[model samples]
Every structure is written in C-alpha cells, then in structure tokens.
Target chain A: MAAPESGDGNNGAARMVTLISSDNTRFEVEAAAASLSQTLQLTILDGGGGGGDGIPLPNVDSATLSKVLEYCIKHAPAAANGGAPNATAVDRAELERFDNEFVNIDQSVLYSLIMAAHNLEIEGLQSLVAKKVADMIKGKSPMEIRRTLGFPDPTPEEQAEMNAHMLEYGWAYE
Target chain B: MAELLRQEAVEKVAEIEAQDSEGVHQEDRLSELPDDILMCILDRLAVLRDVARTSVLSKRWRHVVGLLTEITLSAADFESPVNGSKPTFDVVVQSNMDMVKAVTSILAHTSRRTIELLSLRFYLRDESIDIFRSVDHTMQNREVVKASFAVFPEMRDMVCTDDDMVIYGRRFLSFFYNYPRVFGGLKFLYISCVRLGKFDIANIFSTSIELEYLCLNNCDCGIRSLLQIEHPQLMGLKIICCAFEKVELNWLPKLQLWTYDSWMNSEDRYPLSFGYVPQPCNLRLINTGTTLHKTIKLSDFLDNAIIRQLNLDFQSGSVGDLKTRK
Candidate 1:
C-alpha cells in the first residue's frame, strides 16, 4: 500500500498522468484527480504512469473511462480538502448537483459505469452508480426489476417458482 | 455537446432493447455482477422484507440477501387476515406467532455477520419473549452499532390495561438485565412504552459507552425516585410523556441537546435539574399545563446553564408570568 498524501501544499505543481483504455485510446488527467481511484493511487504514488508510460485498463472501455475521469476530476478538489470543513452551503450544494446529474445516464451506460468504478476501486463513483441502480429497482416487483435490468423473460419453470414465492411472501410483492 | 451525448446514450439503450427482443441471446447481467456490488444494491433498500424478496429472482440471489448488515422489522409487516370486517382473537395471536417465527428465521440466517443496525418494533404479548431471545442471541456475537427495541401493548376498551403493561415492562427489564453485553455497542436507542426502574435505566447508561442519542417516550419510571441519567458520551436526550418524580442529568460531558415535552401536574417547581452539562446546549421545553411554578422553575434552571438556543412552548401561561416569577 502507498502512504496517504499529506496535504494540498503542492497544488500548483500537480503532475499529470496518462491512462490508456482497453481500446488503445490515450487520455491525459491530473495526478490528483486520477488518485481518487485506490488502484491508480498506489501505482501513481510508486512513480508509475508518468510521461511516455500510461496505465493500461484492459477491463474498462474508452467511453466508460471518460465518464469515470469526469467524476474523479470534479471530486478531486474536495477530496484533497479532506471533507472541507470550511465548505460553504453553496459549495456543498453544487457538488451534490453535479453528482445527481452525473448518474443520470442510460441503463446500459450506468451498468458499464458500475463495472468500471468497481474495477478501479473508486469509492464515491461506485456508491453513486450503485445508488442509481438501486433507485431504478426500488418499488418494483421481481418481474419489473428483471425487465428493467434487461434480463430475458422468466422461463416456465422459473415463473412457477416466482409465483410460489410471491404467494408465500405476498406482502413483499404488493 | 450535452445534447449529442444524450442522443448517443438514448440510441445505445435502444440498441440493447432491440437485441433483448430477439430470442437468440439472453444474459442476466445484474445477477452476474460481483457479490460485493450486488450486496451494495441490497443494502440500500429501506425495508428488510424487500431484500428477502430478492431471493425469488434467481438462485444466485438467495445467498446474497443473507449478507445484508441492517435489519428493520415492524409489526405492520405481519398483520393478521380479516374475517369479513374484524380479525378474531385467534387470528391475531396466530399473526404474532408467525411474526416471531419469521424474525427467528431471519436472525438464524444472519447470525454470523456483523449487523450495523437492528430495529425491532412490535406489540407486546406472550410470544414476545421468543422474539426478544432470538434478537439477543443473534446480536450476542455480532457488533450492532445501533439498536431499537420497542413494545407497545394493545389497548383494551380505549385504555391500556395496567396488567398487560406491567407484564411487558417486566419482560423488557429482565431481557436487558440478563444480557447487558448487547448495550455495549449501541450508538442510538429509541425505547417506548416500556416500564423501567432506576436500576434498569442506570444499567443501560453505564453499559452503553457509545450511546449518543436516547429517546424515552411514554415510559413508566419508578415512583418517587429521581431518574438520574449519567453517561459520558451521551450527546442528545429526549423525554416525552414519561412519568417520574424528577429527572437529574449528571456527568454527561458531551450533552449538546436536551428536550423535555410533556404536561406536568407536579407541585414541585423543579422537576428537572442539570448537574454537570458544561457544553453550550440546545434546550427545548414544551409543557402544556398551566403551572406557573413550573415555568418559574424552568426559568431558574435556564439561568444557570449555558443555553445556545431555547425553544419553549407553554399552553396556558404567558411569558409575562415567567418574567414576574423571575
């Protein structure tokens, strides 16, 4: 494990790192922003992913990497402040607005984002996407949740089992 | 640029739906996710029953629901069936029995995991002992950070019968006294409608070192005794509609908020007293009775403490009476 960063003293001299997605697309991001991912933070602290050498993320696609980077950059400053005790109400509200808008994507993209966030071990992005998926499945029945997640329709045997369980625990389905 | 991005996302979803309609390939991507991610989604559900229902989705979800760390069980989740209009006495009893069985099953399954929050609210009856024992046994080895156990006995003839109330109270007192270890990790506790004596209350405050919030509503304390609450980590205390001769706060170093809301008919002016609250506090007093002496007593108490905010609501007396008394 890498030692945690001490403070934001070297904010102006923050280094930049390159990330190579699985499809061979190169993107440059600040070291502070990319460090939001625990996996990337350890490698970057060990003097890795510097000039001419980019971290390869074979599990994440180009589209999902950009979305994940967008979240990391937006949240990097607050993360550096260590929760920002002196943050004004307006500042906190603005970050909350950004989070709410960030997760408002299509179901397929949201699924991909959940995977990328998990693979990178980014805490905030993982929680945001999980909460979005949970909200999508919140008050719906089992069939509704299955359909919303794009699972194929239940087979005859599976449907019979669901009917029996629904009959047993009727309150949950209601 | 945002519009173009939205259009692309919408088209991607449309493509997935188009592929989903064809019967060639079918994938349960949600179920195929890692256990930790699925557990994250399961933990966000507000009700435990909803989590239990996920088992019917597929075989993979059966074991995932058992990994949740929070459990909330309520009486409304197990209401009895009605016969034409009203449920018979036997039906009600059977419903309570079924609820106890359900709770026992859940506890037996989740006994190995560390529970962060466990809330159980049910009407007290003969079957309540089983429910309480199941909870105690399950939480014995687990670290439950927050726990609430409330028992509201059913009222007969528009009044809560004293015999039933005493039975429920004694049950609660014995449960806590027998298993003092359960209180060692609680951070928030909300208890209502249970009878507690001086020893029971003191035992809880002394054992629960992490207790930060305590709410006692419609409780019966021992008669003619001062209910002294002395806890080191207690931050907020609220007492509503509870009967006691007096309440003395002692040694609560971190006490920041204290609220007492009730109608007092006591002759003693000072029914509540502060002993060693050094921090700036937010105090709220809502007395509905027209006792001028009580108002004067509260004013005197306020004169001694460092009150950051005071919210006082009296029904019968005016502020002028309090001023004149002062």
Candidate 2:
C-alpha cells in the first residue's frame, strides 16, 4: 500500500498549498484537500505544485474556498475509503439534504461555487452547483435575468445578439 | 416549498439572463473546449432534444450531437411522428427527414472524435399516409446503424400497411447486418415499437460489440432469442412491448439489470420456457407471472448467482410502466 502523499512528507507524502479566491482574498490549504478539484488535481499530480509547495488559484477566493472545503471534507475520503460509498438510497438522500442546505446562499456565493467546483474538479460539487445554476435560469424575464446574473446593461448590439438567441431558444424570451 | 422553489427559479432565471447578456459572448464559449468537457456536459443532459438543440447555441455546438458517443431518444419524444393524414404525415415525414438530414450532417461534420449517437422514431403506417412505393422503398432501404455514413440509407421502420400491404417482403431485413460501421464504438442501441424479425435482431445484436445497453420496445421477432447478445461489457437490458414466442435468455454474462415487461394476462401463468438463464444479474423486475415462471425454470442454473434484490411489482396491471402515480 502506498502512503498517502501528505503525512510527514515521506514516500511522496509531500504536502502543498492551494490558494483560493473569495472576496478577492486567498488562503493556503493542504494539497490533499485541494486536490479534490479536477483542474487542480492534474496540475498537482503533474508535480506542478506538489511537495508542500504553493499553487495559486487566482480565480477562487477565501470565502468560497472555505465553503468548498466544507463540502470536500465531508465527501473526500483518504482515498482509503475507495471513493465515497456507492451512494445508497439513504446516503443519497442524506447527501441531497446536505447539498440543499449547502447551496442556500445568495446568488454571489452560488456563482463562486460554480467556478470553484469547475476549477477543482469536484464532480459532485460541479453537478450540484451546475444544477443550482441551471435551476436559477428557469422561468425569468430578460430584465430579471440581467439583474440576477449581475450583467451590466447590455449595449444595443449585444442586446440584439442576445435577444436573437434567447428568442431562438424560446427559453428566456418567452 | 413549491413557492420557494418557484421563487428561487425566478431569481435564478434572472441571474442566467444577466450573465448571458454580459460575461458570456454570443459565440461558442464552453463548446470550444475539448471533446472530453463536451462529453461531460452532455452526460448531464437528460434527453436527445437537449443534445440536438446544443448546436443552436453556436457553430462549435453545431456538431455536438454527432460527437455524442451514445444517444438515446424516447420513442415517445415530441420529435417522434404522430399518426395522421396523407398530406399531414407526408409533411411530418418530410420534416422528420429534414431533422434526420441535419443530424446526419452533424454526424458527418463531427466524424465523432469520441462516439456518435443517432436515434430516430418514425410514425407507423396509417390510413392517412400517401400509400406510395418510392417513399416506402426509400424508408425500407436506408438505415442509421452506424454514427456516420455516405451512401446514407434513408431509415424507416417497416410494418404492414392497409393500402399496400402486399410488398411486405423481408429484403429490408438484410440491411440489418450493414448497420453503419462508423459508430462501431456506439455504447447504446434502443429500437422500440418497430416490427423487426428475431433473427435479424439477433444478427444485429451479435455484430455490435461496443453496445453497453440494448433495448427492444414493442418489436416482436417471433419466439426466438431476442439477444444472442455477446456484449461482454453490457450493463443494462430493457425489453418492453416486445412479444417473443419463446425467447432464450442466454449470453448476458455481465448484466446488472434485465427487465422484460410483457404483461400477459393469461390463465396459463407460465407461458415462457427458459433454456439457459443469464445469472449474476442482481436486480430483476418481474411483473408478469409468465416471465417469473420462465425465470424459475433456470433456478438450478442460476443458483450460483444470488440476486441482491428482486422487485416483483405484480398487481392487476402488474406490467404497467410506473412512469406516473396513476
């Protein structure tokens, strides 16, 4: 059995740091905990930022990373648990409840989760957050949509282009 | 809860619209990413319509449907033709042909870096249909077995028609073996409600090695082996509305879920005979007593395999598809 790459920094037990972005703030986290992101997972594995080193995630901030860590800590096994129990009905329901509660933040936090989950490669988090984002897109007018997404007022050309598509898809305009 | 969900939905809609107007450009954003990311995104999409419509997003999305290695569209989907009059059916058929043309063009464009999924549902013969031969001939000859094609055979489900039921020849069945080889790696094949002979289906089943799940809905090939299925990596098998006189259940070595919903209301109770049962299948759902009876015959052979769970929802409409509470 190979030793996990984190304890005592031996037998590839080397540690590293992950810099997350939340409110433009950064916090360094353990490499193993941070490895949960697929984007970062490969970079870390490729030795870009292993051995207790620093890897800056300029996109993620401290607040969102803190929330991501909470979710990952609950879900990430030591790789010893062999990838989160195969999702039995009860466990699935429990996880659902946890997810429902976890995403209960303002639109700002939800957006951060989406980008962070994408960057980190937390598949479950990505799905949950993507679904959360997709859910928000449902049943809203154009003005309401513009307001919720925090997009600045669209220029005339941008508005025309956007309207053309929204009308074409008939999801947003109608 | 519903109101909260609705309100949240309204708020989220507003957000996506705002984002679409600003941060995201009108051109391809995520679609331009590598095929792997595209596949991941497609995996989350529930139906084939979502895949078809992805192309409407931008040029990069133009060929995403073909890039999909495995595509499944419910025969019940709206794009599926509904029975109607000659002109109406012709118009619908033309429109359907157009959609298929568009999809196939997409398939041609993508060349399927990963895989290609093509599924079609045609309206059955009705009194309103034109009762012609050229269209029927074209429908009978062309096929969409593989993901990509050149001499692209027009695809049409063959069945008996009221006006011209004379030319119900078996020539169309020969094309089964010629299923487009381009999609040799296609992971799933689902053909429902079409009347295909059992032997032809067996030939088709025997040929595709990459198929992971095979479903035959309402299509009867007589009493024979529905799946001489040698899909070693196959995981799921669903057969509904298919009538098999005496179908053998052999060759599924690694199947997880095998569901046969042929709800027959007969006093015989045990209508089917099992020759060799595929064991190791963990979840078996039996609503019809006849199928259970057939399964029971293989008890000795299946003894080595222990099913972790057996779901027998046998009631009056025991074989009913539990799609809704009603």
Candidate 3:
C-alpha cells in the first residue's frame, strides 16, 4: 500500500489509517470510518494510525476485524452528519436495509462480531448485534433459549433450578 | 464464596475457549461472554419477563437482570381472549392483574442502577394502581432519565359512552395526583379514548413539566369546548380525532411540531388558534373524515405565526379550495 500523505493541509483528499488485527494483518481504511470506534477515535485524532504505524487491536482477529470494519465504513457517513437528522427518507431507509442484512450471519460469526464490537466500543454495531441476538431468543422459554443459543443440555441441578424459577414466576412463563 | 464461584466460571470459560479451536461442537459460547456483553444483549429485550427468564440460563446471568437500564411492560404482552369470542369482565380483569404481577416481579430486582427509560402501556383498570405504585417506588430509588406511558381504556373507543370516558379520565387524574413525581419526570406521554374536563387537561400539562411529546388520540373535553395548551418543555403535540370546539395554542415556548387530525366541528373553518408560540416549525392539519365546503383560508388560521413547513391534507381532495397568503 502507498504511504498516506499528511501535512499537506486539506488537499481535498480524505486521510486514511491502518488497523492491524491480532493476527498482524494490516488493513487500510479512511480515518473517519475507523473513528466510529470510541476506542480508536482518540488514536486516530492524535495522528497515530497514519504512515508506517497502525493501531493494533489485540482482542479482535483478522476475520472479525474485517466484518467490523465493513459496518464502520457503511455507518461513518450518517454518523458524520450527527445522526443525519436532515437525511432524506431514502438515505435513512437504505441504511436500515443495510443494517438488517448486515447482521444476518452464522451464530459463531455473530458471537465473534459481538465480542469484537464490545472490545472496540462501537456503540451502533454493538446495538445492532445485540438486537439480532435478542431477536433470536425473544419469546422463548428458558430451555428453548438455551437450545437456540447452542447451550449444552442443562445438568440436573440446573434443570431443578429452572423448574423452581418457573414455579415461582408462573406469570412470566405464561 | 462469590469469588470462588466467579473463579470457577472463569476456568470453565477458559476451557471452552480452548475447545473453540477444535472446530467441533461450538455450543455454549454465548454463556462465556462477559457480563457487560450479556447485559447489552438483554437490554434489547425490553420486555422485563424475557429478561427475567434469562436468569435461568446460568448462574452468571442471574445478576445481569438487575443491571438492565431500560424496561417496558405492556398489557398486550399477555394473551387476550380470541377475537370472535367476547371476553368476560373477569377475564379482562385477570389479564390486567397478571400483567401487573409480572411487572411487580421484574421491579423486585432493581440494583439501584440509573434507568435510562421505563415505559409502560397497560389497560385502565384497578390493577393499574399496582403498576403506578411500583413505578413510583422505582423512580424514588433510581434516577429514570426518560419515562413514557401509553394508557388505554378497557373498552374500545367505539363502544365506550361519554360517561365511560369521563370516568376513565378521572381515574387517570387520580393516579396522576397520587404519583405526582412519576408524572413530573415523564418526557413523553400518550393518552387515548378519555374525555377529560378543561381543568383536568390543564392539570396534566402543569404536572408533566418535563414532557417533550404529548399525543392525545380519540380524546377531548365537552363538545366544541375551547382547550388551551401551555407548557415550557413540550416540543411536539398531536391531537387526533378529538371533539374540541377550538384549541388555543397558548404560551408554548418550545413547541416545534403540531399535528391536528379530524376535529369534531366541520362547520368551523379553523379549529385552532395560536398564542405565544415562538418556535413552531411544522403544522399538519388533516381532515380525512369529512369535506369542508367553505374555502378555508390558511392566513386566517395561522394568523401572524410563521410556520416553516405546513401540511394540509383534506383527504376529500379540496387542496384547491384552501387559500394561502404569499
């Protein structure tokens, strides 16, 4: 990749940053998109992720980092507009469509993205993934939720506790 | 002992982390997530019952229930009788009571965390008093930043007589009087199908000091009664299908949007007049039910007020008959 230009002072080109995953893979992206993460915003603001140096995220792996970056790139424009209060209906609808399709992935990938999002402190991505997981388990019984989330079969003690909880709060179950 | 259990959980999670590399049987990874991540997931499950059920997922998830900052309990969450079958009075009462019991049980786990939002939508009934008291108690202990309420009468608007609506309004006022702090802290409130008196309506506005948005659907005072609105923090107001003779927008400093739909009087060209509204930007006047034969003048209706965006929908296709000033 070419070295990012700096000190030119507003040459009308968007400044870029490099983010290194835990596996030491470098991915180049715009500073605005990477700044969507509260954790990365300060570093990007301080001119740390340009040129030869890159922000290394130790907790996020390569595959998950790519997925997280995709969300940040898509949401950066709207976020730059202070949530785009004056955005057209079509623009808002397109973002909604993109978000709904973005989180449609395998459970394992979804869990990885959730953790990466949590570690990176991306508020929008975190809420999107959490809403996806919540939709998966909404209106299900305790046992049903465990199975849906791929939890192992409850032990006898756990089963007894679940039963006791159900007995005490029968209204919730109903 | 609590520390020991946490240590055991961490060790168990570490073991699971090791197994994740094998590429076989990727179950139970969700439980291994940290408490904050788990709390984030549970926050979207606004229904407190669903959040409560997560406690049985494992020992670690039991405390996550208390950390939830947004809670919504609606009577519609409980199953009602079939549509064709007319539910008896007792069935309706029982359903309301069950919803209240669920709400009470959920509130029992308040960890004194600051709640960002607490919204409740329930049928107007005696059991609703229990919900009011529980929410008041929750407010007293914790700081609820934004609270919203949508109250509905047991009888539908079409079936209810004027007397029934008056009684429901009285019950709502009584609840408001009893829990003044809860109403005072509300940022958004929606009331439907209630016939409130002139003073009763004004009293609600006085107590709901922090209100930003207020929606009144299928509600009104007496026939063609002049109702005046004055609030300090209200930004949006919607009046839908109400039987008010005239509505006077009196002294709303922060009002930005007002939507008036289908007033009772068809003979009166304008059903609303403005007073001391400094910042209204959007005004929507919709009349989809009937046609106005007289030519409605927008200049006279708006008087000297300058609105940025005005939407007039006379679904009867009479936009041409309406007059506007240059």
Candidate 4:
C-alpha cells in the first residue's frame, strides 16, 4: 500500500481511520488517536486501515470501543509529544480530570473497558483501569473485595476454601 | 436497513446474555478475566500486605498474586502502635522482625516469578533476619531490573553516636559484600542515620554500577574528612545534613542534579568542589547552619562547570556578599 503524502495540508488535515466494532458499528477517528492502541498502531502504520477498509475488532463491543477511543483521542496529543514534557500545568491537569472521570463507570462497563484496553494493548488505558480496580480493592477485606467486584455469593465449598486460605495466610491482615 | 441492523444486534446481545445466564457463575466478571489482567490489578496494590490480602478473595486471585511482577515490602507497614507515646526500643525491634518474617514468606511464595521491581524499606535493627540474603536469593537470575532499599536506624540522627554509626556502617558493608549482584543491579539507594567510612562509600560506588540516584542524609565518613565521589551512571545525588569536610565531586559524567543541604564546616570556600560534572544544569545549596556567615562566590564554587539553574538558601543566616561571575 502506498503511504499517504507527507504534510498533505496545513489546515490540520490529519489522516483518518475507520474501526469496525464487533456489533458492526463504524467509528471514524483520527489515525493518531487510533494508533494509541499498540495492536492497531502496527496495522495502521502498515497502511492497513485506510480509506474504506476498516480494522475489525471482534473482541471489543461498540460501547467499549467508543469509550476506549474517547480515551485515545484525549491522550494522543500528549503521547505524540513524548509524554508532553513541555505540556502546561493547565493542559496536564485537564487531562488528569478527564481520566479520573472517564473510568468512573458501572462495574460491568469497567470490566469491559479493562478487557478492551488489554486486547488493544493500550498502555495508558490499561494502567488507568487497573489503578481504579486496585483502589477499589485497597484497604478492603476479602469479603469486601468480593462484594466490590460483584462476585456472587460463595458456595459452601468456596467458603471452606476461603476459610482455609485466610487461616493459612492470616499474618498479612495485621 | 439501519433499523433492521439494530434489531439483529439487539437480538444477538440478548442471545449471548441468555447463554451466560445458563452458566454457574458468569456474573463474577473479575474471576472470568485472564491471569495477566488480574496481575495488573494486583500490581497497583503497592503495599505488600494489601497484595497479600488479595489471596483470600478467590483461588484465581491467589494464583495471580503469585505471578505479580512488582513487589514492595516495608517495615513501616507493620509498625506497632504506641498510642501517641514514643515507642520503646523493644517495640521497634519486634516490629522489624515481624516484617522480616512476612517478607521471607512472601519472597518464598513468589520465588518462581520473574520479578521486574523489588523494593524494600526496613530498619537496620534485626541482624538475625538476614534480609539481604533473602532478597539476594529471590532476585538472583530473576532479571530484576529495578531495586531500591531505604535503610534507617532505630535511633534518631541527633541521638546517634559515632559507635552506632560504625555499627550500622559495618552491617551495611557486610550486607553489600554478601550480595554483590543485588547491589550491582540496584537503581536507587537511600541510606540515612549511618556513618560510612571513606572506603566503604567508595566501594558502594564501584559495586552499585547501575545505581542512578543516591540519597545520604545525616551520615558522614569522619570529622571533616574529605569525601571524593565518582560514578559513571549516577544522575542525581542528595547529601542532607551530612558531616563531611569537603565533598569533592571528582568525576560524575552523567550528573544532572545535585543538592547539598547542610554541612558543619565554616570554611571560607564552598564545602562542595565540582571536578568533572558535565551534564548538571540544576544545583541547589541550602544550609541553616551558622557557617553561612562567610561569603561565597559562585564562579569559584562552580569551578568552570556550566550551570543553567542555581538556588541558594541560608535559612536564619545571611549568605554574606554572594557573587556570581559570568
């Protein structure tokens, strides 16, 4: 595939890519934003997601894909600047606010986002979701953690196993 | 056509949900995640106790904890409560031993994993535990890329005697000698409230080949003994309230930032002499000592090295007649 012309336009006419979600939804976004995904970056760099042929992601549903793209589009500029060493405090603070708000979602959506971020190999998104999950698990006991993660009621066998594990490793809770 | 497409998509989602309902525990989404993803979640639980507490969550979580790549254990996490009173010496030693036991067990649990970061912060009071040996065992050939240690004494700096300094220094050196590979691969080292000999500090530089940052606080070699430092990879150095005659920066090619907070000497010339620092652009010199009555000329203090940023703070004393020549 022929690469796009260098510096095609001065009016910020960036190249675009289309991604097809598992639910057959089309998302047209800037190529730089889509490249935040290490998985998509190689494909896009090889001129794979150009023009009408969209990159099909079978693992990510349309909702989760939309959320992941929102994060990528917000963070692509900073990522392009090599972590934006020169980024103003105001700009960095704005992005931090966006990230804190973006991961504030329902439990099911959070899990889906985690899986999507992992499948796409998006480093920033992956860490963000992981940090959120970790915070939920921090300072929580075993039962609290189970409830926080929406784990179903334990069966008698599982309860016995949990009891045995707790009795065995009880020193950590101190 | 779009309406028909939406209908089919809704039906497919409903079908999947129906199939998931037939499973025994499909709602446990986290348990359903792959092992690597769970490890990522647990890795952010920086405190070792929190990471360990995840073991009782489920069998999958216990397995994931075994596969964690980063592990941080600190004695402060297990500090015994003193109820607003100063802790007894016995209490401190007991807590340190408790932490040591926990660290030993956890290190054994995750011995098989290829740990990328292993950090430890502990008081140098329990010599019987041999934390150095346990850490060396866990880190050997495991490709541990970054390791840091913050060693502290049980006594405060003001109360520490020369004998205490020598004892701590000896223990630290012996540990260093015993675990050469561990020291060689260390990325950061912070030692406080200990007196290191001139040769001991020199040996650290030679052995800790990969150390990029070092902080020495309330420590010294001897009374006004000249300390010469040379490191090929160290980028940042901080000497806070350290008692040294003159710290000579003999050769640090990659040094970028240096901070010397306080010294005891009242010499007319600057206590720090830069020899071959080529990359440093930021220099901070702070002192609250009465030795600041003397004048300091930046041109002579900098010794021909180009600096872009300089900060001088002499709290409660006048840094008399400061001069900076181009």
Per DockQ, the best of the predicted structures is 3
lDDT of 3 by residue, B1-326 (tens): 43343233233323323224235444546666777788888978867788878777776777777677888777776756488675556666777778788767667775798889888888888669878888889888888898998887887767888888889888887788899888898998898888887887898899899999999987888777878999999999999888887889988999989999888655545688888888846888888755644446666778856687888888666544344432
TM-score of each: 0.70, 0.49, 0.69, 0.72
Pairs of residues at least 3 apart in sequence or in different chains that clash in candidate 4: none
Deviation (Å) of B84 in candidate 3: 10
Report model 4's interface C-alpha RMSD after superposition on the true interface residues. 7.4
lDDT of 3 at B131: 82
Off by over 4 Å in 3: A1-117, A120-136, A147-160, A167-169, B1-32, B44-49, B80-95, B266-270, B287-297, B313-326
Tens digit of lDDT per residue, candidate 1, span B193-308?
66666777788788888888888866666444568888999999998877766778867889999998873446554668778888888988787866444435445655456678
DockQ for all models: 0.16, 0.04, 0.25, 0.23
Residues A78-143, model 2: lDDT tens digits: 332455466567766776788899987876666556655655557778777766644543444555
Model 3 chain A: ten consecutive residues of lowest lDDT: A1-10
Q: Cα-based RMSD of the predictions, in order? A: 8.7, 12.8, 8.2, 7.1
lDDT of 2 at A12: 53
Model 4 chain A poorest ten-residue lDDT run: A1-10
Q: Could you give candidate 4's per-residue lDDT for residues A1-174 as a string of tens digits?
A: 122333224577888888888878999988888888776766677666678778777667788889999998899878777786979999999999999999899877888888778777788999999999999989998888788877877889989998887766666776
lDDT of each: 0.71, 0.48, 0.78, 0.77
Model 1 docking category: incorrect
lDDT for B187 (candidate 4)? 90
On the 0 to 100 scale, the lDDT of residue B223 in model 4 is 74
lDDT of 1 by residue, A13-131 (tens): 56777888767999898888888887677677766677887777766778888999999989888887776676788889999999999998877777778777777779888898888
